[model samples]
Target: MELFQNVVKLRGFLGRNADVPPSDGITEDAYTILHLATMSGTWDIATNDWKPRIDWHRIICPGPWFCGFTRGMRRGEYLEIEGELRDFEQDRTVVVVGKRYPAKHLSYTVHATRIQQLERPLLVVDTGDDG
Candidate 1:
C-alpha cells in the first residue's frame, strides 16, 4: 500500500549551474542547478508547531528544458518548482517529474515540466520631470 504522497513544490535560490553528462545535441542542455530551499509544512497539530526546515536539492533539466533553463537563469536566482518525486539511479537520486522549476547538497533531481524565473522586474516610473 502507498503510505504517503510524492508531490512537492519548492521555491529557492540556486547554488550554481553545473554541466552534467549526456548531452542530447545541445551542450548546455545537460546542465544541473543546485537549489537551496526552505519550507514549512503543516503543523504537527498535536504540538501546534509547524515543520520548518531548510532543504537543498539537486535539480537537473534534461534535453529541451535544460537548454531553456540555462538560458533563463543566473547564479543565485530564485525559482519555483512543482513535480512528482521519484528515485534516480546514480549520483542524483529522488527525481521530481513535473514543471516550474534543488538543494542538497541532497540526492534529488527535479525533471521539470516547466520552469519560470522569479526575478523582479524593474519598473521605470515617470514623474513628469523631463531629464
Candidate 2:
C-alpha cells in the first residue's frame, strides 16, 4: 500500500481507541494553519513548478501548531527527531514522509512512545532507509 493509505488506516485505528493519550489537543486555528501550509506546496524553488513535495515535516511540522506541541514537551519528555524530508500524500489526511534514525537514537524511542500515546491515528512515514 501507499504511504498515504497507511496513514489513513492508522488514523482510523487511533480514532477507535479511547485510552490513547491526546497530543496536546488540536485547535481550530492550528487546523487552519495546517490547511494553509498544505495549500502552499505548489511553489517549487528548484523546479519552479507547482509540484508538491511529499514531505510532511517540511509542509506541516514547521507550522505554529506543531512547534507549539514540540515546545510544550518537557525536557526528556519526548525524543527529538532530526531528518530530511522525503514525501507526503494528501488523501483525506496528511501523512508525514521521513526516515527514523538508528535504534540507539532517543528520537526513535520517543516517536514510538508518542505513537502509542496518540488517541488518534498519527502516521509517521519512514522510507525504510535509515542513514
Candidate 3:
C-alpha cells in the first residue's frame, strides 16, 4: 500500500517561452522550466458577480527529449500538463527602506511527465470603421 502520492493535472495557457539552459551539466540537460497561468472564477458577494483570478505556476520538464519538445513551444498556447508537485525552501533578500533582511520562502514547482498542446491564441484584426 502506498500512502504518499504527489500528482497534479492542469490545463492552461503558456505565459512565456520555456527556459532551457545550455547543457553544460548532466542535470541541466535533464530539465527545463515553463511558466503557465490558470484562471478560475469566484463569486464576489460585494459586486454580486463572479470575479476571475489567475494563478501562475512553475513547471519543470524532465528528460532531454521532453526538454527538446518544449523548446519550440511559444507563449499564448494552450496546453495540458501532468506532473508531480515538488516543494523546496528558497532564500531571498528583502529590502525595505534601505534595510535588507534575509527571508526563507517555500516554493512549489511541478515536475511534468507529460504535456500536450491544445490550441494557439487567437489573433484580432482591426477594421478602421467605428459605427
Give the winner by TM-score: 3
Clash count, one per candidate? 12, 3, 0
Model 3 clashing-pair count:
0
lDDT, residue 46, candidate 1: 94
Worst 10 residues of 3 by lDDT: 20-29
Model 3 misplaced regions, further than 4 Å? 22-28, 120-131
Better of 1 and 2 by TM-score: 1
- The segments of candidate 1 whose C-alpha lies over 4 angstroms from its true place after superposition are 1-6, 18-31, 39-52, 89-106, 120-131
Residue-level lDDT tens digits of model 2 in 64-104: 34544443333112122322323433334333576443332
Model 2: which residue pairs collide? 54-87, 54-88, 55-87
Q: Model 3, 5-96: lDDT tens per residue?
A: 88899999989988876656426447888999999989989989879999999999988777678877788889999999999998999999
Model 3 pairs in collision? none
Give model 1's TM-score versus the native structure: 0.49
lDDT of 1 at 38: 49
Local distance difference test, each candidate: 0.59, 0.30, 0.87
